[model samples]
Target: MPSHHTPYAINVRGLTKSFGGRRAVDALSFTVRPGRITGFLGPNGAGKTTTLRMLLGLVRPTSGAALIGEHRYEDLPAPARTVGALLEADGFHPGRTGRDHLRTYAPALGADDRRVDEVLAQVGLDEDAARRTVRGYSLGMRQRLGIAAALLPDPPVLICDEPTNGLDPEGIRWLRGLLRERADRGHTVLVSSHLLAEMQQIVDSVVIIDKGRVVYDGDVAAVGEPTVRVRALDGARLAAALTAAGAVVEDAGDGVLRVRAAGAEQIARTALREQIVVTELVGEEHSLEELFFSLTEPGAGQAPATIQETAQ
Candidate 1:
């Protein structure tokens, strides 16, 4: 039996999964520390779902291990009590009421009927909403029900895949707060999503993958430095001058150059000194979305030429 007091950290080491001749995940490795929300991010075909399924023991890995604390998911004595996972939103029977669906799992998970009611409320599915069959529920409602089921056990580790899929703006905000609060209370949380913009607002750290491989693994804030975007009369000349002045310049098209290692004032002064007519110059913060594309987009650095076409 697993100890309740033990800290749970999701550790994936050299994890790989192959389908036929193609690899869905190749030598991927990362750690989801306790008391933090680690975003498992990638584009649509980047093996994010396959990786999460392997972590939950629904899919077997071809190599390496995905462990919570010291035990693989299947080896955990009371998995539901230790880890609550929401991998599929439409997993419930279409005829079952939301509250009844949760109640059905209660016995197997060792949770009581009261827990069903608590979780339903926690996810904002009211009594009326809970009584309706899942077939009649909207996508957002089903998403809430899935979250409610995951929360029923009040486990130490929570794993959710695309929890924000069907949420409205307000619901998305609520989920962000909920996950952050869960981690703040010392639980390990790993949430997978393909949308970089949504994950950017919540994750403490990120593990981005592409072509079934780990492209980046680190603090979200450390990927790129702040930069300034400048557009001038002679774009090539301005870029060259900025490059010579110890700034890394990237052509952003339309006569614009993204200049790093310099602020707006520095870029303005440099343009003036170089006798270049500046059209637009402003400080631009690089978003996680931008960094994600830079590392995972096709033809970009470190990404493969082939996109995953089957079973990713």
Candidate 2:
């Protein structure tokens, strides 16, 4: 088991990376705090991978800085002991057995065979599976091997890019538990993925990007407020009343109104005061997927206000 230690925070400030005339990451800025899972999300073409590479010192940024705590990746005294990353699951020699693959990195990380065996079991890779060559492993198995490698050092910070890509539901659930356990033990975790639904269940905070820039950054719960769905015979009157009462009301057609900034009780009170007939009323909270689409979809206009800004 990894010992508890103060985790290092990840910080990116105006981090930009460009290829030819195109920018992959544009002035990206966000912080991944210690002891929490921060999801780095975006659409297919968003700069998530590039930004992560820059943070790991694998890719040079066109400008700006990506740091681990107060030092850059290259400046870390013992890189493996400070940060363990699983950027690519397929980064393995085809002929190498899973155990050998881990052994190759273990020496450099000051880990022994026992540590290697521990991590292999930690990732659910049994001794039999560990003895198999990478060429014969399934995608999910490969992913587990990669995770085992990352865990070999028991680093304070973990960065996994789409770590759940090839995992089954059970595997995903196991991975979530492992990550949550790490965070609970004071390890910083940064995960980048398009699986919003799964990430919503795993991450405490989210940093959503679009077109190489941050669209939203803060607590996952703060992505959107809970909304009330109401249907009234006097739709127009109710909408007018709700709007006047400081609610943002949207027409859901068929005399139904989707409302925010007001609770069901308040809506009922307003309808009663106006003597309107109510047909249906339900409270709904926007899912992470819905929030992601709203921010990254075309014609999204300006990004919604962040939690920090809303508090001000």
Candidate 3:
């Protein structure tokens, strides 16, 4: 395993980008703490790719700053040693073998061929697979190879964009565990993906954006308030009872109801008092996907500039 003496968090302040008179990113700001996984989410044309490009120094910010470890990415003494990124899996030379592709960057990073081979195995691509040309690899295989390239230099910071696009269930699981373990060992990871359910399972914090602006930034758990979902024998009666008891109830159909401003106890009491049989009751916070929609959907409420500061 590789180690670094200094591991820095990502900080973007008032970042903005414009292309041909259209703003791609508008004053976006967020902080990714060290030793944690942060999920970056946005709908299409939300400027996610543009923002990431600015962060990686592939595209200059129209204004403001994007810094890693208090320094611009271009200012890093050895960028490969400071940060590793997997923006896309299609950057490979089709005719080059997977092993050869990885070897291409070894000299620049000062890594040996042995390290290239090591990373190949780390990403679950055996020597046989490595010997084959990248053009012959599946989408999933290409994704793995991209990850291997990112891990090759063992940088302290990892930024991945939609890394699970072509991964199978098992591949996704493996990638999730790999990222989790890296963060557990004090590495910083910022991942952008549309897989909200999987991200909810792993990310410690999240930054959500829409219309090229941040809609939410805080701990993943704080994204949505808690609500109790209930089901009863008489749906109409339960809905009326819950509403009469000062609880906000939504008819979710199929005899299920979504109740807010009431706990299980209050709900139970209301049901018992109404003589309505309770079939099921579950308390849960807003799922990441639901919150994502609420934040990005048209006419949705905009998140405040400062959401919340969670303890890392």
Candidate 4:
């Protein structure tokens, strides 16, 4: 594990990028704090990769700032020591073994062969796997090798783009644990992914974009309000009972009612009071997947205007 006396937060303010006549990222701004994992999410062509490239100083931003702490990535005294990034897994040379590839980058990061071995084991790339040529490696193996390279320097900040792309369920779990451990050590992590369900379980916060503009940026729990799901023998009667009780109820088809502004206990009591037989009653929170669709769906418009202004 690596330790940092002062961890840096990732900050982007009014960050904009345009290619040709079209805008890729428009006035995007957000902060990713140390000791937490922030999910950078969007649909295809939403400029997630563009934003990440700008953050790493790979592709220059047309306007605004992308700062790692107070300095831009290229301005960092030792960029590799400050931030380790995995932008793409296929950036490797096909003929080089994983260990050799890491060794080649070690000198620049002031790391030794021993550190390389440590990172390889950390990412579950055993010695045998490390010695094989990249061309012979599986997609999952390549992903792990990329991660190992990122961790070789034990940098305080990490940025990854779609890191779970080729991972199996078990591999995904391993990556989650690895990221959690880094954050627990007070390291900053910004990960971009389309795996909304898996992200809901791993990330502390999320920044969702649509059409290259921020739609939602906040804690995952705050994305949407919790609702109560209830099924009754008489669907019409239950709907009326819940409505009279001041709960906004919707007929969710097949005798199921989705009730908002109320809890399972309240719904149950209301049904009992009205002599309505309750067959099923469960309290559920809106899932990350649901929230993503609601914000990005056509005609969904943008999230509340205040979210873009006050997201930090």
Q: What's each prediction's clash count? A: 0, 0, 0, 0
User: Cα RMSDs of all predictions?
Assistant: 6.3, 3.9, 6.0, 5.3
Model 3 weakest lDDT span, ten residues long: 303-312
lDDT of 1 by residue, 209-281 (tens): 8888887777665444577888889989988887898877878777778787778898888889989999887
The models' CA-based lDDT, in order, is 0.84, 0.89, 0.87, 0.87
Instruction: Note the residue pairs that clash in candidate 1.
Output: none
Write the number of the candidate with greater lDDT, choosing between 1 and 3: 3
Q: Sort by TM-score, best first: what order?
A: 2, 4, 3, 1
Whole-model lDDT for model 2 versus the true structure? 0.89
TM-score of each: 0.79, 0.85, 0.81, 0.82
**Which segments of model 2 are wrong by more than 4 Å?**
1-4, 229-263, 266-282, 302-304, 309-312
Off by over 4 Å in 4: 229-262, 266-284, 304-312
Estimate, for each residue in 114-195, the C-alpha lDDT of model 4 and write its tens digit: 8989999999999899899999999999999999888877889999998998999999999999999999999999999999
Off by over 4 Å in 1: 1-5, 223-225, 228-282, 303-312
User: What is the Å distance of residue 258 in model 2 from its true position?
Assistant: 7.7
